[model samples]
Target: MRLDLPCLGVFFLSVIPVNASIRERLSYQGLFGCVHSGLLDHTGCHHFLRTDSGMEKTKSLIARIQFGKFFAILQSYANKDHFNYVQFSNQAVKMNQDFLEIKRLVESIPEHDDLASELSFPSHMFQLMAHSATFLKDTSNDKSRGHLSVYHLIDLSVRILALHNVRGVLDSTNSISEEKIISLHRELRELVSTFVHDGDSESIMNWMFQDLAIQAEQDLQKLWQQVSVHGIACLSKTDQQKCIQLP
Candidate 1:
């Protein structure tokens, strides 16, 4: 499926990965770099010091990103006609069920002093999934156009995942433990590795989604760069040099 957004083409082209393995590795590195660097500067990373509030927010952000990445992988498969109506429908049903459970969990958290509002399952997200499920169920009989519908579904899913309010949370965070971040990075790498080696369909899908993942990583990099550069610029010349020279 072609994206008509002009800016997106530039973003996608800029971060297109050489292959799935490289893309996965870059993602791991990007996350690690962002979390570490973000914590160094008081302006951006200080928020993470609030362990009680920050931990919950960070976990929710990670979970949301995982959901987005998973769907992006699915989109790549749908784009290549790797999924039939039944398989795609089953996956959608499962995703919706998972989302419902997530919603319940989020709602169970007391609102007194929690980040429940910020971390709650988006209502529109539920609506989108429900619509996709119905569309998949109703169109199961049409084999010829099934791929097209699935492609649209994938597109919608990706779009939702890409929403600033969703995946962008990570870009704005300053909290989270180094160990926790590292562990999440490792999990993402393992997930990507599994997709790359799973089968021809998944291998191809990984390759196709690599560009999308890279674009997302690049955005995070840009955020870090913006903050780091500004912070460095505010320091005295010697201090700036020292900051720049720090490994």
Candidate 2:
């Protein structure tokens, strides 16, 4: 969704579930029980942040995959058959060297003043979100609402990165076809329609989570402001109307 949307001119506002709870609402401790930012770049973690002004890939090619160690945690679980959200998230937090490596790589990068911070995920924390989301997705445990809260975190992270990918395209691109826009919207809506969440918010974890979670939401608000700007100036009058209606 992130990689493809910029080329099509930010196609999936429809990815947002029309539901009120989804409309309403993630961080490190705010992270899943065991999740952390681990980029699945074009090479791995959810396509590592594209560094070029949130624009689409200029050239397309698939990276070779070796099924990195992160994959091992998925199958190597102690329980094998079932685990709760805590069990799931902490699975990586254990003696997994790859998880540690991914965290180090994601968090070690200092912020670049040259880039628009709003159009980026802080410390690439989205990798954690993606990692946790992937893990949560594979597990069979939907036991309590905790899974939904974790998903809420993932969904929030996806939007933040999605905005990053779509940053400048609406103002700069004229090639995006109306048909492409409509098709992408329909495809996205169909995909979104299946989402179901039932829960009150989960309690905040440690101070680390609290700090990161606050920053993430603050960052999203800033990006929404940017989107609102483009929406008001949108080329098509109907598109402008949709922009004005953005939550």
Candidate 3:
């Protein structure tokens, strides 16, 4: 049987893993760093931090530069008033260089703890957000050229991360406009909605708990609504009208 949003929420919300404050025990950076904590048990990060491989760091930097080049070409045809998904698909590649840089950065552990922590956020974000491809993109199908796909969201996420310093709505940036922010939020919901039509219940459920809502950090919009806390009021037909007062 197919589970809709409300059923999925109810089915999983109560069972939402508790005990360790994922927020406290596993911070975004901590999780990604293989803190024994998470970001896949914090294993992969050690190599990146400890490696003497200047070659790896050089590769990551080159990937970032390449992304900026591609993105600049994309921006030229953005057509702000109305998004051009076709033009975008024409440009958006399945595997982005931005993600490649992120992956490379995470793999090479630097000597300084502070530096590793600093790179943690983007690396962590990449870990959490990179899989939109599984549910959001289908290379064999015409899905990539569809209205929305993994390529679009990854590009958007990377751009916002760059423009906003990975702060999303938390920090202010003169470079990105109010319209851009609004559009980004809308795109997030649109991407999320697509999840319903794509992946199976188990996989989607895992992502919700592990990445999107994971306390282990790298959650794109931690500062956004506490859907878990407010699900009751939001769902209650009688109570839905009132404001949700967080305790």
Report the lDDT of model 1 for residue 240.
Answer: 23
> In model 3, which regions exceed 4 Å deviation?
1-112, 124-138, 141-186, 196-218, 223-247
Clash count, one per candidate:
1, 14, 9
Q: What local lDDT score does residue 79 receive in model 1, on the 0 to 100 scale?
A: 62
Clashing pairs in 1: 48-175
User: How many Å off is the CA of 1 in candidate 1?
Assistant: 37
Q: List candidate 1 stretches off by more than 4 Å.
A: 1-53, 56-59, 62-66, 111-114, 119-131, 140-145, 164-167, 170-247
Q: Residue 56 lDDT in model 1? A: 32
Candidate 3 clashing pairs, residues 3+ apart or interchain: 28-217, 34-42, 48-107, 48-108, 48-109, 49-108, 49-109, 49-110, 50-109
TM-score of each: 0.39, 0.33, 0.31
Task: Encode model 2's per-residue lDDT on 1-247: one tens digit a residue.
Answer: 1232222232223222233242121111111111223333323322232232221221100000101122233334422434355655554344244434433543443432232322234334534644554555564355454444454443443333343334433344233423233333333322232232112233322221343455554553454455545432233532322422322
The 10 consecutive residues of candidate 3 with the worst lDDT sum are 7-16
Full-model lDDT, candidate 1 = 0.42
Residue-by-residue lDDT tens digits, candidate 3, 143-214: 434333334454455454443322322323233333444344444444444443345654433343234323
Root-mean-square deviation of candidate 2: 14.2
lDDT of each: 0.42, 0.34, 0.37
Please give, for residues 31-92, the per-residue lDDT of candidate 1 as tens digits. 33333232344433223223233243243442353355345456555567356545555655
Give the worst 10-residue stretch by lDDT in candidate 1.
Answer: 237-246
